[model samples]
Target: MNPPQNPPQDPPQDAQLQADTVWLESIRRRIRSPSQRNPDMSWENNAADLIERQLQYDGHRTWGFVIYRTTYASDADWAEFLRRLRFQMEDMFDYFNGRDILEKFALTVFEDRSLFDGASTDTIRQHFQQWSSTAYRTEQQQQQLEEGSGSGGSAGRVSIGRSPRYRFAVQVDAEALHSVVHDAPAPPELDTTKKGWVKLIDKSWYLGRSEGKSDPLEPIKGVAEEDVGWMKVPYQNVMTEYYTKCRSPNNWSLNYRRPPKVAGSPFD
Candidate 1:
């Protein structure tokens, strides 16, 4: 008898869907296929997988990662950098447009040891020592970490600084761009006409400034009214653009003014 004819081979150009659970729980039973099979599939499978997993596990969320680079020549430059950094931190949690996250994890600053040829990890740690000791591990700061306001463990620690090339990692718990929470806060009342004691209803707007306390207005550092327009910007930003005409080498002037309050309507 002729040798059993081999099963008709799939043409090299034809796509085959092999059953795969290589990413099970990530995607239910999914068909495994070569990228060439669906060259026309326009969607990003990886991103779609992430969205699916986030909704299933993390409960529909979008996260923001803030990263920037700077080279500091002196302590003055470092001080200015910190000033702007603190302002951005406050704005991220306090402003209306900033009320995006459900959580914030940590911020880390790392020195680019690669900038220095043959720089060892020990040398980098030593270079970063001054900042680490002064900022992250003070008695009150440690206490705050214990109390849950600051990042608590080693994960919350800022490792490197005092270097020419510095990179920042600001983590936030902001919503995904496509989430549909039933109780998302309303956009800030853009009607600048009326003014009075408007109670802050959006609890997400405050980071920790008013936590556990019932303050009628959120206790946030105020930015100038004109500066409110800058709220939506975070990633890929030029810090100096916002710092212009604003004092530096001193504190970034965040004169915390409460958002314009509107009188509650009687008809409600």
Candidate 2:
């Protein structure tokens, strides 16, 4: 008699697919209210989907950032914006494997030029500096205390660790913003003229070092403008560059630092 054959089993789910499922579900839950959703919501979701697909097929993991233009009429509006952003970030961290991955991401906000009628970019940057310093100091103190407790050392004697490495968000002048979108060489498919909540992916640009030398931008970047948004960048390259930058003595900076040179052909 012939032995009975076992039934075929389903293939294991791809890790990238599993991560994408979690990410999409988190986004859906957060965007429950119409008032809470923004025009770029679809683009952001598309970007995430594209990133996951690339990871599945090509073993690449691309990161993205959004350029938001806003005009705040009152302090209350600004406060509300900050509250929403904080909650969104918290949700992203929870959904995307926590701070280790998210620490590299950031949102760039450029206020409508009209709002700068009486203010200079320097003034705005200075204000942000003061705010960041106070907020980071408080957070750092708490982190030190927690670490000290875990290590069985006195909180007062805890060694000062490296300053928080990444900025979750930043405000920049029109000139600086132009440098990112227009000045950098982008793929021919990308349209730099587009505005209002633009999400760019896999661009080569970096923050200036403490010595005041900005890392020059490289070419063959990808953009997620309008409806079409897809790109593939190597995962190993991203992490290698991140760790390399983390080793720098003057690693802490106020501006948004770009990821390392992307490997492989442009838009591959």
Candidate 3:
């Protein structure tokens, strides 16, 4: 019977189905591939990650950090960050791994915002000492074994400076805090019209104070509007540029920073 009537050949597989969760149908692109994204640029250990782990936020209006001052902007506005405190103390801390990847020092938790605030520039060194103290007990045990000629490896020492006073949560999650910052700046929660309230949402923006000079409207000492590294900038424009990174930088000189969720979160 002519090998039975041959069925029509099936068409090629859909490009969509070939890729699993790896493919984003909406954007039609790979979610994230190592080659496409730099691993060093990620949360892995490097200068950025090291600096980030050592970071502590206090909501205080301090230099080089996002600080919120004033509980009220206008008579009608009685507003301030709720500043919810959270704690996440990991049982173990590990960075990315590779035989070639080695760091002389490791970041350690000294005391979550329970004890210090990173308000001082010397905060880094302070926390380093705190970490050293905590790691002392662990070091002693290893030292004992090594003294007896046992090959027990020595734990790398950790140190930190006084942390900027972040909200007091005894054990804090560095990852969660990082996420909270990243997830912040959404619409309606922040509105730029409020006075005396500027948000330094990005960490990089507050490194320079002088570029294109002018006194920031509320050049509150230690609380610059933004950092214009290695240049003199109008201090007034710092707050303006901060919001612009999120929504409207062109609307410069708005004289206020809005909540990231301001589109509907009360500020709208």
Q: Best TM-score goes to which candidate?
A: 2
Best by lDDT: 2
lDDT of each: 0.28, 0.35, 0.28
- Taking all chains together, each candidate's TM-score versus the true structure is 0.21, 0.29, 0.24
lDDT of 1 at 13: 41
Better of 1 and 2 by lDDT: 2
Candidate 2 residues 1-268, lDDT tens each?
9999999976577976898788877876666331222322442333233233333342222232222233343545444434444454445444433354444343434455565433432344444444444544454456557667987885542222322122222332343333334443333232233221111221112222222233333422331122111122222222222222322344322112233322232321
- Deviation (Å) of 126 in candidate 3: 8.7
TM for candidate 2 is 0.29
Clashing pairs in 1: 62-176, 101-173, 101-174, 221-256, 222-256, 222-257
- The sequence of per-residue lDDT tens digits that candidate 1 reaches over residues 1-268 is 7887788776454232222323332343243431222222212322222222332342212222222222323445334444444454345334222232323223444435354233322233344444434543342235435556554443244332221112112211112111111122212312122211111111112244344455344322342232221122221121212211111222222422233422122211
Give the TM-score (vs. native) of candidate 1: 0.21
Q: Give the per-residue lDDT digits (tens) of candidate 3, residues 124-189.
A: 334443444554345433444555555655434322233222211112123223323333342233
Question: What is the lDDT, from 0 to 100, of the residue 26 in candidate 1?
Answer: 38
- In model 2, the Cα lDDT at residue 259 comes to 31
Error of 3 at 136 (Å): 11
